[model samples]
Target chain A: MSNHDTHEHGDPIAEIKKVTIILSVLTIIELILGFWMIGVTSEGGRLAIKGTIVILMLAKAFYIVAYFMHLKHELKNLIMTIVVPLALFIWFITAFLSDGNSFRNLRNTYDPHFKEQATIKVEAKEGHHGEEGAHATEAKEAAPATEAKEAAPAKAAETEKK
Target chain B: MSNVTTASTKEAKWWNGGKSPFDVEYGKVMMWYFLMSDAFTFGAFLIAYGTVRFSTNGWPNPNEVFKSYPFAGEGTNAPLVFVSIMTFILIVSSVTMVLAVHAGKMMDKKGVVRNMILTIIGGIAFLSCQAWEWNHLHHEGAWWGMNPFINADGTASSTNFTNFFFTITGFHGFHVFSGVVINIIMLIMTLTNQFEKRGHYLMIEKAGLYWHFVDLVWVFVFTCFYLL
Candidate 1:
């Protein structure tokens, strides 16, 4: 049979090669920009560098899905089957980030001093007798704040020197 | 009696061939379904990663942590250049895979073999590059501002973010390694004239799909883990 007869079967290989070249060139350009902008001083410069990298990454992803995955040739229903799930997945990521951030904020509000005091008390009463243990526990409870207060002058002196 | 049987066989053959609804092969359709499932699996991992990153306070800046290589040690300020190279290598391999697929379509088995070999090499090279990046990250000491649980010495203690970094990227790297083996097997099959007899290079085309998937995952990882 002539090649024309076989053409209906789809020529994936030809499409793959064209897409690959485009992806490779784009990747190389991304690498170059990543290197050249290594010492970007300004915040704008930093954002610019970040933006370029993200854009290149997306471009690479687009080529792979479009060509390698055969989404380019698939029927509309099949393409939607792939794309819709992907959008929902991104939404989940956003939600996860928000929840995680909120939890972190709540954790930050608890007093670190209380945790430090509790830790010291747990350590100091390791092996003492009943009365000694109680005294040691009380002392441990009070010690961190006193120590913290005492250390303030030293910290102040250090700051003055700086 | 023989004439009667022959007439019945002819009628059945015409009916079966005239209006077949499904023209595509079962294996090809199945591969597409499998790919869709795999994409969801990866999406779940990425979303989990985002959750962890969000929950943590003072997440390390990707640009600061992943500065370019070669001069990375000089200022400790360069962005993730090595990872970017790894990304580039993968993209290049995807290209080679496409070229191989093209050669397969033309029935130039020699070209297919050469391009497949090139693609395999690219994959191996990318994996090696990733290994080096991981080693560097592991040896770097933990940062001070990281999650502090305090130690016996009254000093602030921290956990290694490197561990999480390695886990996510390492898992993806293993996938790439598997893809390489798959490519090698497909290459061997192509060389034996297996595809030639079938009059199609569907096996190579499927391999291209897999290789491209690897590239796609890395793109997201590179952004979320290295470029963010």
Candidate 2:
């Protein structure tokens, strides 16, 4: 290339090395946190650990974008143009996750037969007709395990017999 | 457009503007725009993942699910050691990409070529590691053909987590694969004197932006999928 003077960007080697180090450090910290949090049983402790690791992850992301991708040196508007729209995704996540959670809660409450144990509860509300009712009652009596949650495992083993 | 008069341009001068409006070359400005949109795309995928995770009653423990490493067979030393290595590969590749862009500015064709090659190799290595992980997961039991959600039958399966795991990582893996492909083409062009003939290696710099974006996405993936 003849006109090296045309592209007058500064030497990025030093910044690259710094970023590499920072990233490595963050990675190590996250690894340690992941493992350490595994043993933590308390919900609060786990959430706190999750928060810490997320912050570290974002830090690494910033270095990769700014130094390696060269965005840090670019015009401020260029950065804003990206960040402004990207910020909306946070809202999207919040909206969707809450909606999904509500859906799950509704399913768990109403879909009693959806899980094995919920079968007994549904059977109580369900009325039986003449001849089939007696045979079905006999079948229910033949089955083992009364706990609702055990319904799944009990049904699984019962099916194995067939 | 209505004309706005300025002091220096009182006469009809040859110059139209003093500096680039975006304050960068047209190619670079466009690349940034492309990457920004792409970042949001990845963000939406991750958000969907988080939604699925929250909605599911029994989300598989990611650490337990990802415990196996390549060749260790079944139980492994650390849950996320392999993915951590993958992360390292991408991070180092981003660094090499920086060197490539730096070399491009200095007009060192050889340095640019070498670093681009290294970056490409790193990308390939990352994809290989991912494939290994996927294969290991398959044999360890969840594949596309087998549904993790066995429903009311009570089979020991990972219904929700597996779905999102495959979806999110597969998407990011696709991105990494494409970045590698782009780098290979850029490498070929660099070696064949395409950019040299153009008098600047901005091509390498642009590819570096893409490589860094891929790495950036991996950071989020590693956190959301493996670590968190």
Candidate 3:
């Protein structure tokens, strides 16, 4: 007679109110941590911050899926039926991400666009090299380089199509 | 008939005509299966996003990308405060949905009607927030980066971050929008006394399952697109 599985008995309203407060507070903690991580500027420290954010996020995901989705009250078999396949999704994303890294490296090696980017850097450096402290000449030099940068991508596309 | 064996009665129960291995309501079990399939679709979109983001080093910072508020600081990037409010709205709506289901259980018709209305309002509010976000992002040329063919940032705009941003969030937003429509239908049915005729409010519970699914999916979308 009692839907005890969902805690829908004996002050059920109070139970849900408590859950709401908890979820809201957790979200606040997440936002604060995110901004705090911003203040730490070391590259290695940044990676640590990213990992912590991910961990906090997974905790939020757990509460949402468990209490909100009511999966926490479902029978063990049904819960496993959903959770097992979701685990595979993590593996799936990792595999694809590795493949993406390979493609990025390959593009840098093969795409002529990389060459154009390099040319801009070289020109910018040369302009800075001469004490010709004339800001106007540097601006003029930067204009042609950027124009070439735009034209360069179109040429790469043509070669790619060929 | 009085002398019938207990074994015979057990064998003759109505389940003899059908199977329920999980020993739960048929409708609820079916809803679980449906949610699993839907989860797979969301997972695939997010996985594609991960692949693209990983491949391109030129992906824009999420904080800088999503930091604009509606009217204030239209030119500045103060990251995540607006979407955080959006998250709160959806969660509050989810709370109202649960309360509606609770009312249905107690056969409190007025309670059900009031809570359903509140839940529907919450859903509409979330959808309105999304429409505003989409309009703002469009004006800011975010969609231009989403176009795979358009390299707006010289060479770093590789259609990686922007493409997934629109596709994943847009998909979640569509689900929230539909949840609102379904809630409105449930509200109308409650007003018409349909649940009274049925003698139970399992329909509301089913819809609650669906609305919760929408909220759950948003948690992941918020993490993937905004927080992390």
lDDT at B85 for candidate 3? Answer: 88
Candidate 1 wrong stretches, greater than 4 Å: A1-56, A110-162, B1-24, B67-78, B141-160
Model 3 C-alpha lDDT per residue in residues B26-47, reported as the tens digit of each score: 7877887888888889988987
> How many residue pairs clash per model?
9, 1, 0
Better of 1 and 2 by DockQ: 2
Who is ahead in DockQ, 1 or 3? 3
Residue pairs in clash, model 2: A117-A148
Lowest-sum lDDT 10-residue window in model 1 chain A: A125-134
Q: Please state the CAPRI-style docking class of candidate 2.
A: acceptable
Worst 10 residues of 1 chain B by lDDT: B141-150
Local accuracy of candidate 1 as per-residue lDDT tens digits, A14-128:
5655776787787677667756655565769867887777788778777778777657555454566567867876677678878877765665567575235333422221211
lDDT, candidate 3, at B228? 61
Interface RMSD (Å), every candidate: 14.3, 11.9, 9.4
- Per-residue C-alpha lDDT of model 3 across residues A1-162, encoded as one tens digit per residue: 214344423477787887788788877887886777656657788677667767776776787677766677655666877799788877887799889888878877888775354333111112111111112244446555433224334323433543
lDDT of each: 0.63, 0.71, 0.70
For model 1, chain A alone compared with the true chain A gives a TM-score of: 0.53
Residue B121, model 2: lDDT of 93
Fraction of the real A/B interface contacts present in each candidate?
Answer: 0.41, 0.50, 0.35
